[model samples]
Target: MNDQNRLPDVPLRASICMATYNGAEFVEEQLASILAQLGPDDEIVIVDDASTDDTVARIRQLADPRIRLIEAAANQGYVRSFEQAVRASRGGAIFLADQDDVWIGGRLDAMLEALATQAVVASNFDVLGGGDRPPIPRLRAADSGRHRANLWGIMVGYRAYYGCGMAFRREVLPSFVPVPAYLHESHDLWLAILGNTAGSIRHLDDSTLLRRLHESNATPRGWRSLRVILAARVVLLRLMVEARRRLRAASART
Candidate 1:
């Protein structure tokens, strides 16, 4: 069935926000993989950040009416492009997509179901060997110092938020910080931390997204992947401290 003529019974509509740069190498394959998982009511918004390659032409070649392509005159990078895509979305639910990764079938279905009663639902991903080794989920230890790091806690930040498999409701979009200008690479972390304050973020451990580990990947997988893990930890710790200080200040005012 064509997604454009979607029926109304489906309780959810998913807007997939895809950001691209010089990703022509695998962008088509990635788009096809995602297009396959989409239900009748799903929508896709692809933001191209002025790719010097044929990425834009390749996307236009597919010409799927359901896919909306936005070309940036100049490169705004992934962070800004992603934000633009999210704002352009009209779906009741929003899912972020990476330009190079492949989504396992049924990923959206599982995540949407998991997020049914919650504010966000993120799934676990398996790393493909060609790029880098996948990191195991260690929520218990990661949550150690901060009590709010509990799966249900608001201070969990983006450390626990998996960008490849995360989805959120459309109404909450306004609360998100626009993709920051700083060179800090973890935009997902920033959104997740802010999201925690607005609503709940539930973990959907069943869905397995294939995280392709290729040298061309934005943060190519390898031993270096540990840097992202460590950075997330540091960010979470600072957020926790700030949250504590804010709470104390509120108490004093009260």
Candidate 2:
């Protein structure tokens, strides 16, 4: 999230927002891992991105009341699919999730604890079955409140802020929702931008989930061309400006 407020008196409801394409093979296991951790007040909001496979059917087969399934008429890609899930969510705490990952035990307790005071929380991850870790270095707890430093890290492409490892309070949604129109990818970094712009994000050192990498992943599996890298950097610069504007507008309203 580049998404929250700190009103402790209000009831706590966690919304796990997930986007799925053709994930029938692993969706059930992922959902089971997450559902086991959710309380009665919590929910799992999933948006299917027009999967031609049995993804939607697998979700419907669950028959869980805590699950809210939204079907897309056509393929809108994962970023907008996630945005739709977030906008449709009713929880005060929003957690971004990927369909192929398994939530580590106590993840909810750990992240919700961070969101209590910070607007956003980004945790670390381990590759499932002891596979190679992500190319970027993991976040350090010592750098939790260093928003400027974190922003620099994100811009330099070493912060490793994957959506599956991030969550935020509801108050910050206005800062990054309706994500930058040109962003056909890297939504996590966009959220990280707004989160750091507001100077309120917690970086957790511990791994909260086990990620499964596959060829069908929405994120590219190989290195991008230098031109693409430079283009993406320009987009990051634009997102930084947009984040500041949104944060200022939100502040004026308050």
Candidate 3:
């Protein structure tokens, strides 16, 4: 262990997975926000996407033994970094975290408890910037039930959108090995949908995170214009096709 680490034994409740790339600017703030929410029982797993900045050095300066920093030999991109970090984790529950977003206190506790039976629990979040936006829509029990009624449409046509608010049981990962690298941005959608095939999966109606909107954000910052909406739909369709193919592949292996 690094001499700077101060955290004791790993917490079994949850593993916070942070995949970073040149996040030195905001990574520390995000880390502090997460650490504040954690009890001594939690653990942090970080994969540096071979950042060309001081991100690794800054992480090193933190003295928490629970903080496991894995520096990739090269830039693996966000999806690979996240997968690698979570796969190496020893925690039972894994919470997906963004390096630049701030998670609200009680977020982990709330998410963990919500997965009591389901293989995953995804909470809602508020998107900031551009305007006074309302909270992101949290999936309700009714939403899950309604979607499952038409599982085919749900799996192949509909998309379940959640990012930093998602958490999964570690065992569900083997189902994702063959996911194409190009489908990285849509990984969360793929995980939740495939999980339902193996076990129960549902979404929580609770709001648990603050998703910051910045230039680096992958999604649009404000209400979508017609052109942007059309472009987004195209991307969404591609994700669904790719994810469906991967899901079929995973099923065949079973």
Candidate 4:
């Protein structure tokens, strides 16, 4: 990483896109963690979803020129907020970030290295902030036994990718952005599905982020009952059908 105040001679290689909403409690720490790994050539683009708290203030306090903040006029959900950040970014590679999670050391370098060969890459992450009892069970593409097959199967079936641990090339943006209004999936999952279909999608066996589990997280974790799981599966199936339809339509246009 280069000095924050200095500019790089080369063009920016990576654009980190983050979406925030009332994330004042951990946004500062997350930003610091990300900043430590970024080079002078990299930039952070944040889209805040009309937060009523000090999330935007905390971000402004950083005062780093590399950090660009965009305040949304109305509170779009997380998916749309992320879409706005990605559209505003100016880098060959785009890394999705969550406002509350702390990134691990060497995350950017590792993901970029992986992205050189694959269209998209997702890394493993350790669950953080959960108490001594037990951490929540999050899926990883590597552990799901479906990476060799269509990677989207694992994503659509198991919901394996987390945005904070994922990165993709700018070329995939055409198919990813303006995320389909009918798909009821998170932005990360949508990207994973599209990236897998567009080119190669792989899982790096490194823990690239500390996934913090807290109450304020946009995607809550209490929906584990049998009926809830079934309903969720139905929703995922519908998303998969719609996603395939969109892919076909895109191919036809191309």
Give the winner by TM-score.
2
- In model 2, how large is the Cα lDDT of residue 117? 93
Cα-based lDDT for every prediction: 0.67, 0.89, 0.70, 0.77
Per-residue lDDT of model 2, residues 86-158, tens digit only: 9877789999999999999999999999999999999999988997875888999888778898889988888
lDDT of 3 by residue, 1-254 (tens): 23214444443777888899988988888899898887666688999999999999998888776688888999877888888878767687888898888887888877778677777776777754335433343456556544444244444334335668788876566665555555656567666656555445667776677777677765445675779556645654665565567657767887
The digit string of per-residue lDDT tens for model 1 on 23-88 reads 888888888998898866677888889999999888888887668788888987777888888987
Worst 10-residue lDDT window, candidate 3: 1-10
CA lDDT, candidate 2, residue 210: 94
Candidate 4, 99-205: lDDT as tens digits: 98989998999989988988888887877764431233355546423543454454334545777789998878777867877644466777776666555777777
Clashes of each: 1, 4, 6, 0
Worst 10 residues of 1 by lDDT: 138-147
Question: How well does each candidate superpose onto the true structure, as a TM-score?
Answer: 0.75, 0.94, 0.77, 0.82
Candidate 1 residue 201 Cα shift, in angstroms, is 0.5
Show model 2 residue runs off by greater than 4 Å.
Answer: 1-12
Candidate 4 is scored at a TM of 0.82
